[model samples]
Target: MHRTQYLNSVNDFIDWFASNLGHASLFAHSYIDRRSNPAAPRTLAFTTLFDACKQYHWKHNGAFGSPAGACLQTNDAALSALRQALQSAINTVNDSKTLTASSAVMSWGGVRAGNVRWLTANSKGLAQTIASVCAALDSDNLSHPVLTSCQPLRFNAGMTKVYSLLVNDFIIYDSRVAAALGWIVVKYCQARKLPAVPRDLAFPWAPAKEAANARLPKNRDPGLGNYHFPRLISGELHAVWNLKAGWILAEVLARASHNPFRNSSTVPALRQLEAALFMVGYDLPLNVSPSGVNSEPESYAEGDWTECYTAARGKLFHYRVEEGGIRLLDGRFYPVAVINRMLIILVELFGTDPFPLANSATKVRVTPSIPGIGYAYFQATDERGNPPSASALAAVLHELGVLNYTPDNRAPWALDFGDYVQRGRIDLEALLKLESERHDDVGELIA
Candidate 1:
């Protein structure tokens, strides 16, 4: 009933991990081998796994942490370049000069770092604050704060690269790192037979292309009882979990030190484990159902969108609102006619985001973006302004007669729903009177 002690849980998980080094559940890794077709999911030696990840994520590779990790692609050269740029920015801040006058906004990790606009309010004390946190991490204080300090003192993903230069053993806590960490923690809890993921072990993950890549499933989130792990990772909680992960990983290296590791001395201790997790977290296959049920995509809609949509007129359907999406017995799914995703969400909940069949996750598994921007109003944000948890939502097919996704493997599926949903052409106010009600789980609905 009580919370699990952080160190104790780490110790327990380390021992268990050492014992089950070859377990398929935790380490079933897949990678493309030049010698053969992409390797199938199976048990792999931890060292072999790490090497595969390193090669997969070479420098400048487009893949997120390609091969294994962002850290893996990095070398002394890359670090030095980023570090020099960071120091130049810091030196300007130290001199109390406006950052606009220095190379404070150079790009790193494919994002702008030390943006002058972001630091306008927090420019004061920034150099000292950064120095203070650097001192903590320099002395191996993982709890010095990274995420919460990302914007204030510039500790974002790109900035994390600079901190790694300043600190002895710091891991970059990007979206991939967070996703990989959360996945591992979830596996640890499940293996330990814990009813819920303890607050100590609850590392939050930011939903990204990684979720849709089949590496981290959107459904494999936290929530066992009173404890609920958020799908989105934010600032303070990000720092807390980041440090906890550092602590656990540090101890794991200590416990596993006796075990033989391939290219043992190539990377540092904590980074080795982080890279392996980073590798496994990318493209991780879904756990097979015990009954051998084929894994298939299901609708994201919350309610029974299948019944004759005339009855669906009053029923409310939501997007990931609850366990199976929320449903109100007498409510409307679409109040206003919007475009792109909301239009998709409306059609989705109305049981109309269908194709040749029904209840499929998406026509294409990749995420679709609204064309031409200007729809930021539909975007959701956390209290701490972290990225939205539903960032990687799958695209649903719409029956816009005039518009259709280009018939190709990588179609955008973008559409404008202006006057379409409400104009009775799509029959939005008329309960989809023009469209056929489709459902896979239950029989098709008849009007």
Candidate 2:
């Protein structure tokens, strides 16, 4: 893609998003009005839009049933309670009562409630610790106070609320937001044609090599393993990760501010950018089904079915079908019901024949020598009289190396039989005739 075109698209999207900010919240209000609204007390309008993006993501990913409201309610209650306790401790201190960490914990009625466990073991230092961090935060020196002073209560979940509420410049540095910033950093580097940044530098939330080893799939090393899966960062690294996250956010914002497309008068705030990057990194609506196509699987009655095919390397591969899914030769499993439906749709649209006759005898045979090209075909017998399972059909198509299914739905399926051209010129006329007969047979069966 052309860089200028991509940049234009990004700017256009940002403009559109900024214009629609009022739609994110329950009540329609301008960004300026919402920011100044004390009663509503909303975060930046971009944050609300980002939350909407996340909701769309969850719904598409089949996990939208989670209790989002309940989670928010609990967090709100905890933050409110903590603020009340902190105010009471401050009032007592003003009245000349000794405000020890233990006394503060007692003042809060105990550390067992809500997310107050960070003050349990370090109860003795709670009052001094928070005071020092707040002081450093006020002075714009968070590394020493927030990172080092707050030991058990690290920067992310522990001190984020305090800083974000008190400090005008502070932005939340939780795992999700950090991951999103990392993704943006990587993308920015790629767009600028810079050397790839270290994964650790980009994604601070990833576990260390030693910790990651245990979680990786068997027989896979760090280089070959899938790093897409999310892992929790250890507490030991939280301080460093938070520092790096903050730095990355600052750098990204600095770069974004320099963009000529950005309006200097109405440039997006760092928090708004943070929300946008979070949506980009996380499963948001844009990354989901942009098209109207429903890529998710439809219900299908499933049964046990097994099929075998030979790979390009001549190694035999087996697909064991169970329910709506299939287990590949490499032990990786995929749900093929949706894929099968899509394949059916494609065949219906293209008028191509679906392979593997439902009633054929169990055997593998090479197609009769065409004028130039020949192909291998697998014939499987089903005495149970059940139709070929979707997994079985998909497995056959995959073996042919001509069916392409992009799970993300970012692209449509493709069929490329060019490999046969290298062996010999394909007999297009005969192949077309055979396919025509098969399509007719399939059409008759459907009727």
RMSD of 1: 16.9
Model 2 ranges with Cα > 4 A deviation: 1-115, 142-156, 198-203, 206-237, 243-447
Clashes of each: 8, 0
Residues 355-385, candidate 1: write the lDDT tens digits: 2111122322224533211122133111111
The lDDT values for all models are 0.39, 0.34
Query: Model 1: clashing residue pairs?
Result: 53-67, 53-68, 56-66, 56-67, 57-66, 57-67, 150-155, 215-284
Please report the TM-score between candidate 1 and the true structure. Answer: 0.47
Task: Write down the TM-score of every candidate.
Answer: 0.47, 0.33
lDDT, candidate 2, 29-110, per-residue tens: 1122211245665433333433523222111000112122223233233334445555556445432221222222221221
Which candidate wins on TM-score? 1
Error of 1 at 94 (Å): 4.3
Prediction RMSDs, each to the true structure: 16.9, 24.7
